[model samples]
Target: MRNVLITGGAGFIGSNLALKLVESGSNVTVLDNLSPQIHGDNPELSPLYRSILGKVKFIKGTVESRQDWNDALVGIDTVVHLAAETGTGQSMYQIKKYSDVNIGGSAILLDLMANEPHNISKMVIASSRSIYGEGKYLCKQHGIVYPNARSAEDMKLADFNVKCPVCSVSVELLATDEESKIHPSSIYGVTKQVQEQMFMITGQSLGIPTVSLRFQNVYGAGQSLSNPYTGILSIFSTRIKNGNDINIFEDGLESRDFIYIDDVVESIMLSIFKDEANYQIFNVGSGVCTDVLTVAETLKNVYQSNSSVSISGNYRVGDIRHNFADLTLIRSKVGFEPKIDFLNGIKKFTTWVNKQEIQKDLYEASIQEMKSKGLYK
Candidate 1:
């Protein structure tokens, strides 16, 4: 991992990763188009892109272009592919954009490495927990089960709990492991699933070490607060800052594994250099489930804001009820464990949010986009 190339290296995770690698004496090169949605209209002036201004060899390009991949791959030994369209609800309509960028871009990178001569020795892809859909659960009669998406009919009646596919009984959430089912409920998740599979297969054929890290809800300082389609922490923070009431989806019991940014970066670092992590898919998370209501309450408390937390019975089509990562595989294989818990992580994130300029609340507009497509009730 001497000379590294990080696709989408100007974003939250990528900028943090690039800084860490540079501190470790690795020559870092970044390839990012600096999308206005994430980086704002003036990308060059955006804090994310400016964070890596002189620290790395930055290339303003997109992964969909083969010439961009060729330019970014020069003399690079390792590739951490983090470029993708990550909005789950938005992906339901923008199927072509997500597929072309996430899957097509990945195909180009692997095709170049497989056919063209390169010094690439290792590859680490950023996979999402969304690939597991409703994730793992335990039922009294079924023992352990992988439930499907909660139905619209059930959700319309305010019954948002995931039921066992085998018995149709309400199931208890379990820590989703690496061997869980691969049925994605959204187009974004499907793209990530394909990206991971393609990388692992091509890497094995090329005789290069490959690792896939199925990251849970990653949030911390430096994340984009302006992006309404993803990153609940950031979205909630933006709403609170604008003095707008925070409206949580569903019954507000939908839980997720919220891992801090530093912990996520550490897991990726371990994967980059560890020999045991080769040809393995590991779950990266804090291993604890935190519900959406708790997140809203904590943010409001931490920010000392008067914004109310409302639990709307409304739900989206591709939303999951609950999912958390089982860290046994990552901990034993890569020796990675999260340091910051939810409370402490939220404190750190809110402190950072306090310093940044308040972003406009676009949550309603985003929801309207989904509602117009009939994906949101």
Candidate 2:
């Protein structure tokens, strides 16, 4: 069995990946600082923690520290780097904190790996669709945008200009390929782009097999039900459970390509074990874009609740009007395809949410606290 190290192994995506690896009989080690917002004092992930508590080694430490990296990398053959400060709007206010963790901390990890005794076989990074910024989509070889709402006849291979209805600003509707331009609107996106560059450059120079998976909106079990700073699904689920209004920042027209946690874990495993994934970048998404309104509607329908959804005119800075992934390369390279559809995924998530007997008021308070701290502004 290959020895694998998963950073941020207590967080939603990381923990899910770790569970899969451990179940497959791989020797897995989880390095997590257990940030309060992500994993601290919460019972949502307790089942995961309990399952692997004795089976896998767990280290509580920040990725920004050199000693943490050294200790985590001792017997690891593959590294799945998933740790990051992911609050997009909050990153605008706390620029230094996001940079220090997402960019600076990632660089340190790469540096530590470069000095390891046995040559590390591979390194996989969890990247974001936010790196494409506001207006773009992922393009297919035929140059068709996969998730475009425009009819087949309306989509033209020739360059086309698209405008955000809210901003009225004209933008090119080009789908970002692996070679697309790196334009980040938020500090979170900027830092993620930097992290991807650092891995690519370090891997090239050090002869380490590195791959980056640009993940779309990932949501599933083990997600912190208490954190309001991120995880829109979790936030909405909590609010609905409390009989409170589901707040939409804008007109609820903003769209995203949501990928399930299981699909994400599979993609990471493919990159770790497959020789074809070396030194490459792939998009992990469902190749379909669903808007916020649709998601909210789906949740409400699933819960069989009449919880009112309030579409507040208030908008967050650095909010993208639309973003989705182009999945052609990832499908061809890693043979990865999202198994769960959005409707089914939502059903599964709702079932899980209903089973949890957590306090609803606490989640609402957390949302208010985030707003008060200017983290969600």
Using TM-score as the measure, the top candidate is 1
Error of 2 at 282 (Å): 0.7
Tens digits of lDDT, candidate 1, 1-377: 39999999999999999999999999999999999889876888889899999999999999999999999999999999998999999999999999999999999999999889999999999999999999988999979899888888898899998898988889988999999999999999999999999999999998999999999999999999999999999999999998899998888988989999999999999999999999999999999999999999988988899999999888888988888999999889979989999999998998899999888788989999999999999
Task: Report the lDDT of model 2 for residue 67.
Answer: 90
TM-score of 1: 0.99
Highest lDDT scorer: 1
User: For each candidate, what is the lDDT?
Assistant: 0.93, 0.77
Worst ten in a row by lDDT for model 2: 150-159
Model 1: which residue pairs collide?
Answer: none
RMSD (Å) of each candidate, 1 decimal: 0.8, 5.9
Residue runs of model 1 more than 4 Å from their true location after superposition: none
lDDT of 2 at 230: 78
Q: Report the Cα lDDT for residue 214, model 1.
A: 96
**Tens-digit lDDT string for candidate 2 (1-377):** 88998998877887788888988889988988878676547633565555567768899888899898889888888999998999886787788999999998998887776775754788998888888775354333333332322222222232223343334334445445666656777789999999998998998898889999998889886677777767788888888888877888656776778888898899998998889999999988887888888888889888888899876644555666676777889889889989998888887888888888763445556546557865443
Error of 2 at 98 (Å): 1.0
